[model samples]
Target chain A: MTDAIELPIAANSDVVLVRQRVRTSAQQVGLSLVDQTKVVTAASELARNTLVYAGGGRVRIEVVGNGARGGLRLTFADEGPGIPDLELALTDGWTTGGGLGLGLSGSRRLVDEFDLDSEPGKGTRVTVVKWAR
Target chain B: MERVPILKLGDVLIVSIQIDLQDQGVLALQEDLADAVVESGARGVIIDISAVEIVDSFIGRMLATIASISRVLDAETIVVGMRPAVAITLVELGLSLGGVRTALNLEKGVALLEDRDNARAVAVPR
Candidate 1:
């Protein structure tokens, strides 16, 4: 099963719309509320990052089923300032904007697999996956 | 979109979050918190995020903004009982809440609010 949804909106005011869409789609694939919530959360966080920092980004969501278990994957790509330091950005308690340094680190924990790629002055891309295990 | 009540802690008010405070939920709350804090002028505000599982950058910014806005209004802000997973996500994403205060429980948050009111009452002697 190969299905994906792509959403591109202004980073300024599109967080809720994106999260709700992801949640609805995840459920349509027969994902439980728990799994759907996790996916919704990840999508929301990534969307927020895209809007707030990157001035907006794109969300790519795909669901794949394998035998007894299925999984959800989300990729958030932003062409903003990009992260200057990946390590520092990933570090808990370390934040440049000084909010609850828990977005990415926290999102990583919610899902099963997480990957991040960013180059300064280029862009940032975050991919997260959660398996129905 | 429920209207929150005047959450009372002793003599002070503990204004629970009106917005969902999750990823996108933060947007609605973000635009409202500062003004709400000022208008309500509650001695303390407790952002109950137990129902929320995630907080993104925009949400983080809103939380920060609430706390900052409260300072001028002679009020304090406390983020209460965020899920452990959410906390970790924020830390990893580089959304550090250096200025905002957090509590393990809503009771603790209320107590803090009460204490702040007492402190102010003592200073102003009203």
Candidate 2:
């Protein structure tokens, strides 16, 4: 694991910034154009979720290496009204917030690994990683 | 907030997105395009996204919404120049862009609009 860069997700512009930073880090980890696009797209979804669902949050982006290969990892955490049902939240086309509801489920398909943790009154944290192939 | 420019060409309105758009910019473009379609009385609207690197659900939905809005306004919307990688990502992202029409490039997009116009003219006399 290398040094991580953390950015605040307070508004819509922050989501764009997170995407840009994730794309840069993905490239630095030697991910291909397609992989970079995938991760960056995933970052955009999660970043927006943090801002819109959680009101505000922060993200930590880092480059990771496993043996000989490299990967990019992102952790998005928000302290707002957390999800009560993880399964429902991950369901396709399920949304309480007027969005298309693909933010969580769709992003999960884009990356290599995904983990979501949330409590109704606590917070939500989503961690995703995409390894270079 | 930066706004995407809309150019007029005869009966078509063209918008080429060259910047990494924020969500607000995306919404603004939608409103602007709808207004332009009504005000200019354009028959077709073409969006060029060759310069855009990624298309998340928000942008994907924006395209669909624009198409729906233009259809109601009696204008056709064609999205052109989607990168292959973005295409792959979009499919995996579960956004089929069902109601949106797409072409490989701007020229083909214009040709498609013209073809549709010709077809309509043939189908209806006037």
Candidate 3:
């Protein structure tokens, strides 16, 4: 399973398209419906966050797995104003926009693995993984 | 997406979900909504999602959360208008709504609730 999906997040709609691609790709590689849905959901959330919070962004979902613990790794990057305090933003009930502030933090709950990186004036990138047995 | 609120069939409140259905607001709304629906004295609820283009694990979980609250409040919960594409995406992605009820569309979902209320109304004749 060596497929990488990359897309620019200029509009909110693109998030849906890219997430669909991830779902298809994961299923193509023997990922179960449940596993595929879990990852796609997380990926879609990241994509939307990039579009809304980051102004615009892109994504790359790579398959990284071994045996029973196989999983998908999603890399979401955006060029918008990065989060000044990643720790505070990760806190529940804390949001800049009207949302529940669960885009970054909530998405983390769906997958089995999570990692995020960002810098003010630079950009933000989030990575997530969902396991399949 | 347009929201079409179904009125007066019974104690059931059906709110058409016709937006992005993304992010956290949906999550918090689920909480407030369950309480609101229960507080509104509704016997059941149906959320239309035909216009929704995308769904994630969080949405699935949130839907389940809504169902849980509804059950605790003694109200029925139903999800309507699930697109085939979205369903397939969720299936392949391994995302599931857990225990929430689903319908082909809002009309069917509302019918279920209305049917229940209609039955109850018939049983309690004035």
Candidate 4:
């Protein structure tokens, strides 16, 4: 059975909520402390980006399991002005705002699986997963 | 508006971040710490992050920025009580917390700062 949780990312405080939820869900799946922290931190970065860049959005946290492994997945969706250059946006130290610019690239490094899709005029959806070891 | 309180301990400032900080809270902390350092003549700032369970690139950058600001005001910043998980996550997040000192706990952090102060005093011969 898969369990999922949804959180609205409307403000800075919501970012904190997303982190808490991610941490709890990661812990529920028996992920290691390090793994839990990684997912929580990644959730925070993405949630903040959803608010700061996208103005507001929603995040869905889910637990997935195959026969061999179980993992945590998070999807952040936003209807804001999307990125025009995916490559540049994924580059380290690249920011369109006054931020550290480590949100996208760093989050990708913390998880086992990463996926990002964005359109110039439509919206952006980011999905990340961390498998239990 | 949420604010992180800064407590003055002798010439050191102890900021225990218990609440999950938002962007404004972080910005407020930077401002408050900078002011406290200048107003109280603090020579060391100890930030206790034991209660902060999650730290992303933004919080990591906030720590580095605070350290930089404190240093410019002649104060050394030491981040303490970072959990093992947090340490691993921070490295993976690609934030080295450049130029920021760290300790295992508050006692060690304070001792380290005192050692630095003593060393500075000795080196200055004053």
Best of the candidates, lDDT: 2
Quote model 1's TM-score.
0.64
Q: List candidate 4 stretches off by more than 4 Å.
A: none
Query: Ranking under DockQ, best-scoring first?
Result: 2, 4, 1, 3
Which residue window of length 10 is worst by lDDT in model 3 chain B? B1-10
Residue-wise C-alpha lDDT for candidate 4, range A1-133, written one tens digit per residue: 5999888999788987888888888988889988998988899889989998999999999999997888999999999999999999999999998888999999999999999999987989999999999
Query: Candidate 2 docking: what grade?
Result: high
Where does candidate 3 stray beyond 4 Å? A67-69, B1-54, B57-112, B119-126
| Index of the highest-TM-score prediction | 2
Q: How well does model 3 score by local distance difference test?
A: 0.73
lDDT of 1 by residue, A30-112 (tens): 77666666667667766766777788878888887777777778889988899988888877656665555656766776678
Residue pairs with clashing backbones, model 2: none
Model 4, span B24-122: residue lDDT tens: 898899999999999999999999999988778878888999999998999999999999889988988998998999999999999999899788899
In CAPRI terms, model 1 is classed as: acceptable
Error of 3 at A123 (Å): 1.0
How do the candidates rank by TM-score, highest first?
Answer: 2, 4, 1, 3
Give chain A TM for each model in order. 0.89, 0.98, 0.89, 0.98
Error of 3 at B105 (Å): 9.6
lDDT of each: 0.72, 0.96, 0.73, 0.91
lDDT of 1: 0.72
